[model samples]
Target: ELTNRSFEDPPGSSVTPSGWYDCGFEGETPPDILPSPTLNIGKTAYHRSTYLGLTVRDNNTWESISQELRQPMQKGACYQLEVYLARAHSYWGISRITGKEANYKEPALLRIFGGFDGCDGRQLLAETPTVSHTDWRRYVLQLEPALKPYDHLILEAHYGDGPMPGPNNGNVLVDSLSNLIPVDCNANPGLNKNPEPEFAKRQMLSPKEADRDLPLPVSEAAKGEPISETQLLELITTTAPRIAFDPAGNLEHSHYTDPLTNKGKWANLLLKNILDGLAQHPLAILVIVIPEKDPNLAALKKQNLKEALVDLGALQEQVILRDWLEKDVEKVWYGNAESGVLMRLIR
Candidate 1:
């Protein structure tokens, strides 16, 4: 099951909703989680208090959000999800190309990408033609990953062929996503599996129900500057003094960390280390080592760690998860050991 599937996380003009990470360009602002009065969209949410607002700008860049899935999507498997989509004709933004205010009223389409990381966009799984409706409408997207398996999903707003063809301002409102359901790949495509009148009722949760299990907002006192790489290295060295090292004093493995055992202070420290590292370097990628024994449990373990990190506000592109034994025979899971999580610097 997906966490915060209905986009129930709190909203802000620039803040990425909880459980989702921004995947916009380097210099671009992140997508807005909205229903804010300041945006002046003059729209109520289709489901709860807020919805996702994505834009395709004239500067050839667009907005998107991604999250690591609780379960990896199996290759060649078919999955469908229901969501509400609408177009806000009064949406406005400052155009980068024109250097002035402009209406982002043009319709935009939704593009879904699946990959092994939070923002890889390795495979384009599904795309809608365009959402031109001013009222909330239900859309069931069918995704079939024909290539490799995927553990992450991305929702992107893209330009559509409107009356004026070239790149311009466009906005799409997304809300109330249903659970991702697997179906028969060969079944008649585009047919609604559940045509009952109460289908919509089941998709949307009440406000009280939506708020349940949601993470509490981070207070100002809990926020601070991220730690530097140098600081992080020192922390690891000081905290894990018994860690095995090579002749050159480089890290070989940690004696204190055994993912299956000793799940207390050391584990929390390890999580903190990861959180600090990702916060400092937002673009870095993670590499999770999947062991041969109980591969399914290993996948679930990785998902749990991912959710933990995301819950603590770590939003970088996560590691590409795989069964190391099946993918490679020469390279060991963690240099010499059988299991552990590895963080790699992409630079």
Candidate 2:
């Protein structure tokens, strides 16, 4: 039910303790004495308990810990704290296969830390509460002026040194350490956490968006701009006095146009395209072959002859000229790509 969570760290991940460095692992690890600090992987804190036995990966790295908060949370915020704690821990044992141990042992911690700051990597927040036995328990903390709510939380061995083995190197099992509080800052300000979303969108569409619905080269862009919609439309509708095409797909018109002219642009465009195609060769022709020799081919040819009337969904209906290629492809003569004579035919 607690709303507080370990920010920055994903749930049940060892990386929860990111953004800081140099900290103690356990209060009192059994059998030997060694501390090299900064561990790879398994660097997160979780809830555990001897009652629940060792949580598979206990392996000792299961010491309870917490992340340092960002800053001073707003004063009057509705706050809730949920700590997944296991008053006991047993990630490892001094018994069985001891690399260099004679006695196996693990201890439960008093309290875990939560929502804290000061990252010299040696700061402690809320102390864990002491627990006993094989059962599990949950606890909540209310922010009060008297106790002065802690900004951070830790789930490792309690702050002071304890003799019962619940010390710095001892095992501490904690499920999750979280706190959720709605800050009521007097001066509300927007948080700048992870701003890549906005920047990413801009970068993705910057080039294409710059030309959309815009006349090219009008403002900042140096590239020649697209013609105005009105001008382009007018040109599409206008018939040209004469048209010529060049090797490059461009139109050369004898008629001069004033600013904002679009009188015959589309017709001009169509003609220009034709000229462009023809420029590549003396003549450009499309020939479609419909066989007339074999019986099956003839049947297919007959079927093609009925092309003007194509099936139009429903049961079947006459196909419109635009809807059927046959009417437009009457072949000036009947032939296909294989006919040398048909290939020479032009519209």
Candidate 3:
């Protein structure tokens, strides 16, 4: 294992542990040890005690911590490098260039490079997709030096080129880095370059061609000849009424009673709309689908909403409450609008 692999020794602000050199831009801050307990950020280090934290700034500048391998990598040998990564959801610091307060939450990525030079060679080895989650996750990179031997490895953290707009500055945490370990490459044929040729040939269908070979789409399969007028009328009569409310709206408040008059007005407007729908379809069922993770919290919201509806003359038995997982709803509803409760007519 690499020396000081955990980065637990000689710890202090902007300090790089022994055996690792801070090769980032001059005058810029190097990776530092994150304090334990990571308060207020809602994350914990993958390993107990301290972890390494690196930053990337608005101008696209980044930081890195590197080390020269104690021994040169053997050519044609398979190695596996593993590291744990997490995003710093929120960070507050002053930019060295602008000297302004930099508060942002952006994604950070880990790129591993191996080369002949000390740590500055340009050969790319392996890179991870952006590490954007606040929770710690492990990433592994398989390395097989085909020809030239590499003497150094550099670990970099920086922003990815994603179109989604976000704060330009961000931080990422690195912890529990494992040394590149040699594995039995022959035992794992998939990891080795010598996989059976027949196996590769079996998976050769292009995506477009494979999609063309699939059965008819679900929408087409469900489609049938047009219905008669009597059948359509019966279908219309059996369909239930629905109304939707924004999940982020005033109804999400923890309190049952509206603290502000404007909130009460908004609640009343939603209740009035639901009541009108119920009146037009007196025999139809009233189903309320709220997008929430917690069933208990959703039930509470339903109870509060029902009470508001009761004030508007809606009977308790006429309403049904349900909680739809947000992911399931997103699969069906493609609207870019903000999250909300979706009440829909159903049979």
Estimate the lDDT of model 2. Answer: 0.29
TM-score of each: 0.55, 0.29, 0.50
The C-alpha RMSD in Å for every predicted model, in order, reads 17.7, 29.7, 16.6
List pairs with backbone clashes in candidate 1. Answer: 286-319
Rank candidates by lDDT, best first.
1, 3, 2
Query: Residue 203 lDDT in model 1?
Result: 18
Point to the candidate with the largest lDDT: 1
The 0-to-1 C-alpha lDDT of every candidate, in the order given, reads: 0.62, 0.29, 0.55
Question: C-alpha displacement of 250 in model 3, angstroms?
Answer: 45
Between candidates 2 and 3, name the one with more favorable lDDT: 3
Task: Please give the clash total of every predicted structure, in order.
Answer: 1, 59, 1
Instruction: Kindly list the per-residue Cα lDDT of model 3 for residues 99-207, writing each as its tens digit.
Output: 8986646777777777766558455556777777776655656667666788888888767654433336777778767678787656445533322111101122335
Candidate 1 residue lDDT tens string, 203-246: 12336544312432322222445666655444433322222211
Where does candidate 3 stray beyond 4 Å?
10-12, 36-43, 161-167, 184-347
Q: Against the true structure, whose TM-score is highest?
A: 1
- What TM-score does structure 3 among the candidates reach? 0.50
Q: Residue 325 error for model 3, in Å?
A: 51
